[model samples]
Target: MAATVNIRRDVRDSFYRYKMPVLLTKIEGKGNGIKTVFPNMADVARALNRPASYPTKYFGCELGAQATFNDDTERYIVNGAHDQNRMRELLDGFIDRFVLCQSCKNPETELLVSRDGYITADCKACGYHGDIDMRHKLTTFISKNPPKKAGKKGKKGAAGADSIAGQPGQVDGVEDEDNDDDELTRKIREGAEKVMTEEEAARLIAEREKADDWAEEDTSPEAMARRMAALGVSADSSLLAGDGDDDDEAAGPYGEFAAWVSEQKGQDANGLSAAELYKEADARGVTKKPHRLLPVLFPALFDEKVNAELPKYLPVLAKLNTSEKTVKALGGGIEKLVEAYPDTIKAVPKILMTLYQADVMDEDAIRHFATHVSKKYVSKDLSKKVRKAADPILQWLDEADSEEEDEESESE
Candidate 1:
């Protein structure tokens, strides 16, 4: 044995390695010459609702999720929903949310052990599992790529530089905190921008900066922008799916939709307000009336609306631009991610849309949303149904897997 490098704890070949595969293994089930050495299956599945899975699962961020890995083949699989080909691998500290168990959609999970660990995470909802070696992975990554230290700058402690470690690198005076933060923050922001809006990013920076009760307030726009930009986007293009700005026009077949709903008309009540009427238009998914409301306030808006069909009213954003609309509908969506679950919310669009289609108003999704909601978005009472409609419309995805047909059952 040359070095006997423990891959689970020692490798740092690529920044993207181990991330996606670990996540995928959690959901798709393990694949290798070996099988799960642990006995109980059902007992491990129910640990999600509570903090622990005395038998099947374990609790807390300190504790990692459960998963199985095969030694001989070196291939991993999940027991729940996932897309293996699109999975990513990365350096341990690089922040990213790879996949959610189709059952509960919790992305915060970590696989504590890869080979033979006690705890295993299989979402009770739809039955998904993942694999990760927490301690070994973290230690291995940190050891492989030590942080480059820059010259220790004690020039009047700036608020940011205060908490940063003031250690010197092996080379003379070179602990580049500025460069390090910039690099890390850039990666974080880029990752987030792939699935969120500019406005959303700004808001998230502001929120996360303040959410932590112990953290000092950072209200500066430049500071917030830097923070937002720190959370990098993913290298995976699947996360960047859908049309850009130009494609946002004709976002949907809205003309056909408006035509279909044209027959129904509400009375132009004497005392009824324009805002109320416009809201009605939105509810009916009819933009024509709402577009009409714009002409009164801004004559320029009318110009934007000429042939300004449902969503493509150029600058005037409409619900037809599903991406933007999703952000708009989810009040504080972009802004709250920092204070909210930073990684997950930044990449929640696809999973949310999937859940919306599945017709399942998930409790976990709701709790996550509740945690992310800002004071501006929260209300004392139910003023309207914005939250309700925004709650993903529960639906299911139809997926087919390759499996052998049971000839024994057919013999009857």
Candidate 2:
């Protein structure tokens, strides 16, 4: 029997049921033809419930070497001599990104590819459904070639099987054996059930369809280029879809205008002042649509330095908040900033406080924004993430409301 190790390297329990064969590599040939062959890659991939080609491709991407898989002989090869230890370390990174559940750290995740070419994960262990970071190069490959559906399990490879001790080649789906009830698991199931209820299912489906409106529908050359640009990837003609016809249609007036502003700022040594920005908008015939432009412009204007830019642009933002609609637009603009600069998610409370104090957005607008999520500017999931980061400010706002009510009652 080949030596096996825990699927999760950090899991040192001797009896851990999820196991895979320890990596075995052999360096072949010499000079230019020299390569590393993973002898038992099929067994390891079977244990992880992933295609052998995936890890092979991942190794190629990470090592900057050419990886090839021969279907006839089921051979996996990388065109460079790689040590077992180095390959094992890279395997850990693969497990972290593709195998382990984001919420539970279990290896029971199923990759879900959306029609829009995005990859998400569904954890059977903890019922966490979340987007996998699309920034990785491997995601593009995974999205193009999704996993094949498994056949019905036999008794030996059953879902309830606790250990693969004797069957060293069995799949990894070890269920948690602890008898204690997990509150988080219970809540997640409850939430899922609520969404699936007959009365809400239709509404939920409609919302989901609406949310996908902004997602990519086809793999056209222009579409692929736009998606790659949004993901911060350089355009690669070989990897992209469609024939090499370059269609440079703008992503909409709002996004185009924001891009123009960013380009203009980059070209000019001295940044555009608030008045200069207003004048530029006037020249471009976009001053009337500040509501739409503001959301995309907010991030474009400040890049990642919102703290420094917010105060300087407060007067301009204050002037734009002339009505309730405009105030709500400002709130949406802040949400865009959070979406663009995820590190700013933690600073959501401070951002909201700054805008509120400056009268750019009123308390009522801020409270409403905190409670409601819109897919008009960003994805619903990103909106929820931003709100989650604003919990401290939300709680403070609630407490202040309660105190005001108490004071009014005492006066009466």
Which candidate's TM-score is highest?
Answer: 2
The parts of candidate 2 lying over 4 Å away from their true place are 154-175, 178-412
lDDT of 1 by residue, 1-412 (tens): 0001111223332210111112111232345432222221221111111111221111112134333334244333323332222221221222222223434443223333333333334432244675433453333332343223323331111111111111100000111212332222233334345434635776587677658743565434444333222222111222123222221211222222221222121122132222233333444454433222221211111112222221122112212112222323233322222222333332344434422222111223333443443444223232123233333422211110111112112211
1-412, model 2: which lDDT tens digit per residue?
2345677889865435456766667778899999999877876776676788889899999999999997568799999888777888899899889888889787767788889999888876678999999998889999999987654321222112221211222322112323113222233344345434643767688678867884655545565456435522234444443222222112344455565566666677255665556545645755455565566567667656677666656545543444555556666777777766778777788887766543344355577788887876678998888777777877876786675455334323
lDDT of 1 at 220: 47
Give the alpha-carbon lDDT of every model.
0.26, 0.62
Global CA lDDT computed for model 1: 0.26
